[model samples]
Target: MPRVVKPKDVRRAEVLDRALALFLERGYENVSLNDLLAVSGTSKGAFYHYFPSKEALVVALAQRSAGEAFEVLRPVFDQPGKNALERLNAGLAASYQVKLGMGVPEPIAAMRSLLMPENQALFRKIVTIWEDLFRPVLTEVITQGVREGVFDTFDPEGVGDMIQGFAASIQDYLVRMFDAADAKSRRKTIDDCVKRLKLYGIATDRILGLPDGATVVLERKQVEAMMTLFMPSRPAGSLP
Candidate 1:
């Protein structure tokens, strides 16, 4: 007979959700294991059993984040008649939209933390994970575009790197300027950026007629609701 599953997965998932919240509100340096335990409502022993160290937990979180992102875009990429560039751009835009709603302070928050001397190695490992996820999809798109004579370039590997860089930049800029803590400014920034990105496209508009689906607009609403909840501003000149 098959063995029954334990509650460890459930507990670990709970811990991760709390950890992500704390990490979003407070950076990695500010949050301690004690903080994680308190926020997660789990014991130190349980936490340690699941995650031997805070770094280990963070590594798991990073991997999960990247994996989740890939899953969200896989559907778009698999759609018929969508060229590599179309898939690439759609993926980037949709992912950014979801992230904007989800209270991700920055797209590269985990990567940025790794930029420090102590975290550089960890950062590299995470980059490898992301690269593995993006490289094949990007390369295939480039190859297909070139075969169809829609694209001028033919270097799949270089094009893949460019795709990753472009996505990262969009995230960094959107999160910093549009998704800022302030509500009014955040809304304005998001409105402007969304308008511009929709026009210019994220990567290259090789494949024609890609649909936006519900990801961008729905996520934008979520952000608006979050801003309302946290900021709760009133009409101009209303307060003394």
Candidate 2:
């Protein structure tokens, strides 16, 4: 019997899936193209055929991950049964659940990597891609809230931008706190973020579905290990 050959798209997807797992396990910079090919069980030619460089691979992975997140939340915005705020809250809860289910540190590792000055260009490109992809969805949700009188903001587009900026700031703050091994500061920052969102007309109850004064808790040792893996230069200390 002749050996079966995979379709081009299937082969490309398999390579990407394997590469993503490798990148998530070992930080992107720590994994070379040869390492990716080795883990993916793909020839150098096939790897190059799909991704010309490691940077391209990273971009592809980011796009796919971001796209999946969007898909997960998109329906909440489109579905008609729920009120605007409820939909928004459901979408956020679902997103958080997805992140927790992955049990991977890709988000933290990728964010830390992008914060480095050397990755500034790639970071900017990714920011642009995410802004383009998410802005419309967020804007639509905000617009729905405004129409339903749930949000007082007159300018949905501007409010959407502010919301995105706020979320980004919180994420950056968490990354910094994780680096510093300051879990107390991390929890405080999360509370502060929730309070600020309330000021923006977001209901306190829908503040990412987090309980009062409580934030998503991760295993301290696991988080510390991930921080060390992604940011080795930071001084180690016990998590607060």
Candidate 3:
């Protein structure tokens, strides 16, 4: 019997799945087109038929991941009969659950890689994509909170932008702390995120499903070790 042929979309997904695994195992910069083709078990011609280039593949991966994340929280924002605070809490929880379920570290590691000077453009693009995807949803939620008297922010849109910026900064800080192998920095980063959230008029109880004054204890050594495995190769003494 002749070998079965996969559909174009199926083949493309297979390539992406393999490439994502390889990129997760090795940093994005370290993974070449040849490496992707080799791991994906697809001919160069077939790979090009889908991705065109490695950068395109990375962009697709980022966009797909962001789209999935947005979809996970979209229902929470759209759900009726829930107040702003409840909806916001549900959105946050849904996001956390999705990340947990994915169980893949490449998305976060890829963001860390984009922070490098060489990948500045890609990083900016990713940030813009995230802002575009999240800002309006956040603005709607904040506006609802303001009308419901649960939140008293004067500028809902500005607050949404700030929240997105704060979240990005926190993610970057966590990656840096992990790269530096500093447990204290990791702890401090979490504390700083909480402080900033409170400053934004987000009630502590409405954040991350954590109670007010809840203590967050992370196993720093283990997490640092895990991050070290994914840390991009850099010159000695260079900041992450």
Q: Against the true structure, what is every candidate's RMSD? A: 7.7, 6.7, 7.0
- For model 1, the local distance difference test gives 0.60
TM-score of each: 0.60, 0.64, 0.66
Indicate the TM-score of model 2: 0.64
Candidate 3 regions with alpha-carbon error over 4 angstroms: 100-127, 145-155, 179-240
- RMSD (CA, angstroms), candidate 1: 7.7
Clashes of each: 0, 0, 0
lDDT of 1 by residue, 1-240 (tens): 996666988878878878876765566677889999999877889889989999899888778776876787778766788765566557665765544434454543443344444444455455567778868876776677677755557476786676566444443433344235555666576575455445444233422233343112224454344333333353223211
Single out the weakest 10-residue window by summed lDDT for candidate 1. Answer: 209-218
Models ranked on lDDT: 3, 2, 1
Tell me which of candidates 1 and 3 scores higher on lDDT. Answer: 3
Q: Cα miss at 99, model 1 (Å)?
A: 3.1
